[model samples]
Target: MSTAAAELRSQRFAAAVPDLERIEAMPLLAEIDALKRARNAVVLAHNYQAPAIYHGVADFTGDSLALAQQAARSEADVIVVAGVQFMAETAKLLNPTRMVLISSLAAGCSLAESISAADVRALRRRHPGVPVVSYVNTSAAVKAESDICCTSANALRIVESLGVPKVIFLPDRYLGHHVQQ
Candidate 1:
């Protein structure tokens, strides 16, 4: 890393974590940076990630939509997502040619788990011609079943963009309610 980049990273870590925690994390952060360079990898962290991972190791950090956008634009040989499984899956979907990895197999979303591809198919059967608008939090299978996918930030716009009077919003009732309101 350049001196300026290192300084900036240090500043970010300092701002995000206590001095003692930052000190303890320095070695692991350095290792992560070294591995990233050796493997030609980029770390994409979600908004919900720990401050240490987000500020210390993440090459790019944002919401799921932004992370997917970054993943699509990334030229790195390997993409590491310090987020949930759905976000990692989104990255893989956006960059099918690249190797995408998540930190943990257990890092999952309850909202995404609440519905499945079968559920989406059932909704389609029940609603007939109504379009399926899946939240980005859904699994890749659910997304594939849907007509379009959207993030919380863009749900209202995406739903409106469909030019349909009625649509089925998946999984998260709260987000769907927010979109409806």
Candidate 2:
């Protein structure tokens, strides 16, 4: 990294961290920067990530939908997602040619785990001809089974755009309800 860019990264980390933690985080942050440069990788952080990850090393940070959009548009050789598995999966789906990595294997989401591709297939069988509009929170398999994918922000619009009278929204019942309303 250039001197100016390194200084800017340090400033961001310093602003995001408490004075006591800044010293401890410096080495790790430096390591991450080195790895990013070596791999030509971009880090995408979710809104719920810690400030250090969000503002310190993340090249881009936003909600799931925005991160997905960023992943689709990214020219980086590798993408590191500081979010749940589904988010990483979405990034991979969007950028099939890029190497996508998750920060932690243990990271999971209850909403994404709530349904499976098999469940979606069954739903399709039960409600034939009804288009399935899956939330972006679903796994890649579930998304593949879905007729279309929509984020919470665009669920209603996507459903309406389909021009279908009824659509099956998956995983998040609350978001489905909100879209229905």
Q: In terms of lDDT, which candidate is strongest?
A: 1
lDDT of each: 0.90, 0.89
Error of 1 at 82 (Å): 0.2
Q: Write the per-residue lDDT of candidate 2 for residues 102-134, one digit (tens) a residue.
A: 999888899899999999999999999999999
Q: Can you tell me which runs of candidate 2 are displaced by over 4 Å?
A: 1-9
TM-score of 1: 0.91
Once all C-alphas are superposed, what RMSD does model 2 give against the true structure? Answer: 1.9
Give the lowest summed-lDDT range of ten residues in model 1: 1-10
| Residue range 1-181, candidate 1, lDDT tens digits | 4578778877898998999999998898889989999999999999898899888888888988889999999999999998899999999998899999999889998988999999999999999999999998989999999999888878999998989888999888889899888
- What is the lDDT, from 0 to 100, of the residue 154 in candidate 2? 79
